[model samples]
Target: MTAEAETTTGSGTTTTSGRRPGTGGVTARRWAPGTQVLWRYRDNAGGRVHICRPVTVVQDTDELLAVWMAPGTECVKPVLLDGSPVHAEPLATRYTAPRTTARARWTGAGVLKLARPGEPWSVWLFWEPGWLFRSWYVNLEEPRTRWACGVDSEDHFLDISVYPDRSWLWRDEDEFEQAQRSGLMGPEQARRVREAGRAAAEVIRSWGSPFADGWEHWRPDPGWAVPALPADWDRAPARTAP
Candidate 1:
């Protein structure tokens, strides 16, 4: 995973930014093209994290790459042909579908930001593995802002996210209120989250993944070893001098 550029929020620390360009048309590519190459980078604190997820690049334009991962998206084996992880740590994070959330229930897109080590935000998108459904992004998730796009499974959309400090909270008012008390977001961050709702609505209008029977893409074949979890998955990250 790579940091395209470090963005400083009005707060301390850097807000790394990456914009998933607006998707093209379904005819723009193909829905569920192939196993797409996914680059994930995650750090528990400020150190390297367990990494995995790789796909071969078949075609790449200056803007996009037609990629695929062998064994498809379910290959959780810890090593690739080069002894790298089938998946790897991520730089920042994208969004994904939550396992328990019912589809078509997205109120809107949202965002959150924490400069220090703590729970990040939750983000969701609509994408497919075999083809590219560029019009809309699918998948729903909690801790939504912690991930980007990865693999589109057959049963549902499988997304990647940095381990979250806060757990998944269905769009209940309690969770919304907690986000306020947690000091995880600021006025600007909250505004961005609100704007994210536009993307969510757009995906819906386009009938994308998790929004478009993405639940069908959720099943993952249990084969290789899934990544091991840190001793504490829910602990907020602590800032350390690099």
Candidate 2:
């Protein structure tokens, strides 16, 4: 999930300016590294969206796609009860309460999200400006379903962050638990989320494809635009294939 700069199209690989292999009228092209793209997630299956960020592409290949969400960028995130942290509120009022957009900047260095085709989760690496690796955040969510404009997935709420030394901790256990209590996620679904976290930790410990990839040294294209929040960002068709 991440856009536009000089690109080339030929053979199996095509630039965003050209059509992808399968889609008829939909233009699909590999966004070059350093290109800015929008990373977003919808709140409901085919309903309104709740999160949006302009991220810099790090790697885009047949195997995996990586993007960086830098700090200080204007981003859209969900807030409950006058900007209170979502986890701090009681479970009963969590979803029933008024939800609003919070204009926020990423506080830390930034986050690098790595997603593979057909995967259920994206392993996000957090760090400071100097590439000081902070931790790997395993965001357990719906497997990303690609669309004409960008990728879409629903946040599963539960997440895990793993340190450089391989130590890991649950980042949003309270929210995950609350969701279950609120009748949002069933026990079976919770188990699946935990399993996904463990799988991501294994990848971290082994220094997998993305961690070993040269993304830390990747830089954004100087001419890349600061992507704007589109008015139709929240809108998507009723069905999308992953």
Candidate 3:
């Protein structure tokens, strides 16, 4: 649903980091709170971006990167070539349908994304119109690759929804299965995604840091302006060596 940043040690304790974990031994500088950045996801089949949202940084330490995607922020999202919403299509042909990007505004309440570095999933907080805390959503995906403009990951389709009472349920399972059947994901990749889902479920069962972190009470700064969707929202990120 959304994304952010934080750090965890080998023992699973949360801590702060001045620089993000780097590839090729080069640490990446963290974005300051309130900085604008693009959060994006690439299509499962091709490396082309299919979803993009501009969000304001809430926190950017190595232990966690948090961001607020304010209501009304313009964004790019996938849609059927017929200009229909992707979810409106039948599951049988959803992933097989021709699709394209469409610019739209994020409606309703915004989301707070909490992500730990190198984790395969990010947790998101949602609220109702009056700021009534809704629930936490675990979006299982690949570890986000960070670049100067923002971060990118490929969605794994499988997800979990955690409620206030600590009860949780799997979400998008049909979509997950459909994706594999549509050839968007190979059998091996699907297996790994399922493994990641089980791993995330274990964390949920234990009531881990993010779910217990009190992010539901978190609110955005009143002074922070909503980030604009930039013209180059789909710009390719600079490559980082493994």
Candidate 4:
């Protein structure tokens, strides 16, 4: 079977755009429902943001969910994913790779899980933050998608959308009907984020910058909801985790 053979789903990342999906180019594909995926996050400064594990199953409300038996320090909202070909999988993640070493300095956290005993690569980025798997210019990983969020982090806006191809397009989340407008994202920063996703696809793909790698996984602390952004704290949307 090819590496993309398994159709599993867990939490990773996805894109939200009305644009079109691409069909030509070689890039990493997403997992099918029932496959496990683990994820870790870091800021531009390379500091640990937070870690989350989502399942691939679509909820009654059409939301994707993944459950991790975490400690008490973490909170995960049933992440709301937008875009095509979503699925749910049943598998627990195990963060392999050492976390305490000089070389592992830049690598913060990751999940560890077992797959087919002999499966070649145990962990994969089921979903990314910006978009789903597939497409060329838009097929880049979410971590590498450079974004300039709304000023002051208010209004709760996701600057740009990413696709499997890594290509990108400008987006005005505030333009959405249900969107709650916040501060402004400088035009320059917006343009950069919109262009970055597409431009970085191949450059990063060539170096293999993936979402959930064995070396970065870490078991969550416990069950909880993702904290509301302080900027949007006044009007933070209610959270629901699976």
What tens-digit string does per-residue lDDT give for candidate 1 at 169-231?
223333333444444344675555444444454544565423344332333333423222223
Query: Scored by CA lDDT, what does every candidate get?
Result: 0.29, 0.69, 0.85, 0.27
For 70-172, candidate 3 gives per-residue lDDT tens digits of: 9999999999998999999999989888999999999999999988888889999999999999899999988988776688999999999999999999999
Off by over 4 Å in 3: 1-24, 239-242
lDDT score at residue 105, model 2, on the 0-100 scale: 73
Q: Count the backbone clashes (under 3 Å) in each candidate.
A: 52, 2, 9, 58
Off by over 4 Å in 1: 1-170, 213-219, 230-242
Weakest 10 consecutive residues of candidate 2 by summed lDDT:
5-14
In candidate 4 the C-alpha lDDT for residue 7 amounts to 31
lDDT of 4 at 242: 16
Number of the top candidate by lDDT?
A: 3
lDDT of 4 by residue, 1-242 (tens): 22232332334323221222231332323333233233323321223432233222111111122222221213222211321111121111111111221111112222222222111111223332223333112121132211211101111123333344545443433332122211223455545444544444333346343322222343333343422223221221222211
How should the candidates be ordered by lDDT, best one leading?
3, 2, 1, 4
Whole-model lDDT, model 3: 0.85
* Better by lDDT, candidate 3 or 1: 3
- Cα lDDT tens digits, model 2, 1-242, are 22334355432223554333345545445656656667788774234678988777767754687877766777888888589876566766776677776767778676778898767788887766677767667788888776545677888887877766667777877777877876777889888888887777677778776667756565555565555666655665443333
**Global lDDT for candidate 2?**
0.69
Q: How should the candidates be ordered by TM-score, best one leading?
A: 3, 2, 1, 4
TM-scores for all candidates: the values are 0.29, 0.77, 0.89, 0.23
TM-score pick, better of 1 and 3 = 3
Better of 1 and 4 by TM-score: 1
